[model samples]
Target: MNRILIVDDEAEIRESLEEILSEEGYAVSSTSSGTEAIVLLRDAPYDLLLLDIWLPDRDGLDVLADLASLETDDKPEVIIISGHATIETAVKATKLGAFDFLEKPLSLERTLIVVKNALEARRLRSENLEFKRQLTLETTITGESVPAKALRQQIKLMAPTNGRVLIYGESGTGKELIARAIHSESPRHDRVFIELNCAAIPEDFIESELFGYRNSAITGGPAEKRGTFERANGGTLFLDEVGDMSLKTQAKVLRALDEQSFVPVGAAHPISVDVRVIAATNKNLEEEIAKGNFREDLFYRLNVIPFFVPPLRDRKEDIPSLAREFLRIFGREYGRPRVEIAEDALDLLKQYPWPGNVRELKNILERVLILNPHVHRIERKHLPRLVYRTTGRRSDDFSTLQQAREAYERDYILRKIDECHGNISRAAESLGLERSHLYRKMKTLGISIRESVS
Candidate 1:
């Protein structure tokens, strides 16, 4: 139900509003003092506030100032009520964030209509806030590895600044996530975040995508189209795979960054914008510049703040946590909640070198859940064969005999545990060792028991 708080010094007026709004199916609360209304608002959320100008305790305008000062997003839409209604007073109330004004001889029909509209506006505002919150969550960089922690700290320090950022990472290493994280934490967080993939767009269309066209710049395009830069004004524009941009396009981007304005195709006047550019690429930009493929001026302009996202293989210890997070995410999405991964399965994941990085791991987990919908618990055998079969390290990959032996033992024990369905006793018997001895060996090997099995 839509909630309304009525703040009127007149007892009869408050009672009348309460009764009428209650009949209209609104959850209504009334207070005679502006002070009490402020307290009520602080205590709970209300969709609308019917505020009276003549409160015995305090002036309604002062109350409006207090409401504006309150650091909260759930502020109510205020409708000002006054017996001595004046144009100046209405204008002042409006300036103080009042949604509308009501006169002494209130019109029942008009009041109801205004109240309904205010509530609808409140609902829309709430939805927008929720949508932005979801977007922020999606950009969260997960993991506790050193690189991950450092990246988050770097984002926190650099995000508040307007300086351009250039992210460096291998393909599928989450360069876009890093860009988004920076934008989400930046001063322009509340503004739009626009992303354009330089490599994805064809050379012919890339320029138009970055700086929109007017008057049907393309043979049969729209009359006028806003480009990523214009759409991201007062916000952030993320250019993914920026190294792939042609020198011609790079020159234009350099100019836009320098002047904070651009002339759209087929347009005479250049539009000015306050945009923060964040670019990311898998290729070494310095090498690109050396080869004359990338512009040095553009590189220097965007490289003010540089970020590197480490590949998954470099942070293999974070795989267990990342794997679990992906499983939980995909589990809820696939209608298979409480999905558990066997320790043996996790060991295989850790052993494999993820050339595709975190993105590949996420895809593999989602694929596993999709292919095995009926299985609540994922075992080693459930993983793709490539994870284990191709994960073995060559003898030369190991520096010492001890390292190679430990790797072999760990793999053998994991295999036996998987074959025995995680039965410690049977695995120990098969290995000709006591259960207690096997437990000690498993502990020495750093194998954790994450799932219970027969």
Candidate 2:
């Protein structure tokens, strides 16, 4: 049976919540003091907590701040109850990690509905998390080269520790893959492994996105949400492209890293989380620090477990193994019969300086498989023109010109849609295309635009 805890100073209120919840087949517990609530919560497991914002002996927000320090997975979902709450206090409660803010004149019907929804949501979330973990494929280093073997060894050595890690590598060098590998081997393997690309989000949204904001925290903001640190509690948080983060945000992250707690964007109360931090970057951070673009102090904190991912060019010996693996996967995915890459073609792949790293190799192999419909064994002659050249640009002289154009156009449309707020009409107008024509193009390209504002 699901468990519920009611923490209200008013004896009548606590009795009401407990009687209502118990009638609905829930295991119920009640407390009138914030101090006793904290003790009970620490001692036992409760699925949900009904917290009062104001108490006789202490403020209820302080109890929430205390609950936020929980180190166990059984931390209860908190719903704040208040009789005289301002919008500001409601938002502050939300930022302090309250699941929901409820008014004091609680309608029995509304209370039951909210309580049922919160419990069901938690059940669904837990189910989805377990389902995702079961479906995810395991990542292997897939190389026998010196660098690859050394990296595997280093990960084995560092996976058990709680030290913060800083990974250095070029784009597509499998930094994320290595991070996941470490997580999989670590003590926190069963927990979540959250990732955020620091470069992908804009400067203003970065703070709110990472630390989250309460409802209506900023001028015309969206609803309350949990941030990365909170979501990754008791797990690992991988910060990709950490060099791109602004120095101001870096300082805030540094403070949270040190204290394991932080105030949300517009809330006074602070929430604490226990998250293992793993940061990755492609830029020379030393140079960025010298130029005052990166934080020196944050760098030292994250660099406790320094790791350097070898670029594809430096680990050329791994190319053949990686290439074969990609070919096998793509061959099955593209519905092509079994195929093979000749020795000469494999040698040519090794000769090329893969500036895009392993990602380029995977994409190129997929293209080769799709383009070679009749050839079961890929030869050097079947490779694209850009593969052997210094530049990736294709002239009209290439045979795969049409295929390359369609691929580029598909990518361009996706980017335009993101920039246009997922609005097909806006994206079409910006791209100088008629609405109907753009609709047809999107259908032909297998693109689904959900925000179809007419």
Candidate 3:
């Protein structure tokens, strides 16, 4: 439930407002003085604050001023409620971060509406803060290696330009991270960064989402809907897994690039935008074009500036740094104080082929942290068994080695299947094996379809 704080000197007013807000299903608190309200706010979390200008102790404006000095994340919205305040005071309150001001005679309906609006604004601010936080942690490129340094330099150079960039890498190689970094570092950083995973979005709704429809009488009355293109105006639009974009959408995208504009679905007028396109794909565009699954024209348009993100194998030197980063991140996430990886554990990680890349590494570390808890150091025994067997470092016994190898393969295949929701074709593609081969392997490994999934 949303928490609200009501501040008023009058006992009747505080009680009445508290009753009204509580009846409306809001968690409400009340204080008679600004000093007490400030103390309460400091101690607790509230979504919105209802403040009276004529307070016995400190002025409400002073409270608003103090709120302005605090960090954005912890600040709750203020709604000034004053019977004896002037328009000038109301304007000043608004200028000092008040969401809105209500007169002395507060109508329950109007008060509720303003409260709802304030809560919505606060929710949006919270969400944006979370988005930015995630962007900083997950999107920021992390490495001091030569390849990573080069990648950063490339982003700095190409980000300023309006040319579209094609990011190439394997799955979980942080291609989206590169895309976000380029946009965040660019001149259009203030504008929104809209992302669409071409592979994930269904083909049917691609057009509608990329170029929104005009809400018409036939379709649904003439209300204009902004698509991702419009939403990303004066900003960056990242098309993830661009190679997976259907041929039809690819052609439309090519046209949009050529014209620098597009009409919404059912709209007559074309809307122009100054959006920078950033395309990423795990697949090789040349091969995709050869297979005729991707458009050649679209490929050329998006590949104006190519950025190839090296796979984990190519950047093995960064494993220690990356592993330590994951250890720190996962440790905090799993409520562990501080966790570190032992030398042997780090060596085992370096030896494994991280086919799933950074994402996989983060996931595995999270699992380890959850299992181990607040432990200080992670050792080789804490490592997953597949890491050893898959790295071709098995024991002397042929039978034991074979069993280990089969176990590793079984675990790998199962993970892939689970990732793709047990879709055989998708899992096979991820494993770089034919569907028939995967089926045979599953059988040979004694992985029963029913028992395994259940």
Of the candidates shown, which would achieve the greatest lDDT relative to the real structure?
1
Q: Pairing residues by index, what is the TM-score of model 3? A: 0.58
Better of 1 and 3 by TM-score: 1
lDDT by residue (334-424, candidate 2, tens digit) is 7775789889677657756799999999899898787767779987667654454423433432347654565466557766766786787
Cα lDDT tens digits, model 1, 316-365, are: 77888888988988887777889999997887787777888899999999
Per-model RMSD to reference: 8.7, 20.5, 11.2
CA lDDT of each candidate? 0.86, 0.83, 0.82
Residue-by-residue lDDT tens digits, candidate 3, 227-272? 8998888899999888888888988899888998998998989999
Candidate 3: where is the Cα deviation over 4 Å?
A: 1-135, 217-224, 391-454
The clash count for each model shown is 0, 0, 1
Candidate 1 has a TM-score of 0.62
Using TM-score as the measure, name the better of candidate 1 and candidate 2.
1
Q: Give the local distance difference test score of model 2.
A: 0.83
Best by TM-score: 1
Ranking by TM-score: 1, 3, 2
Question: lDDT for model 1, on a 0 to 1 scale?
Answer: 0.86
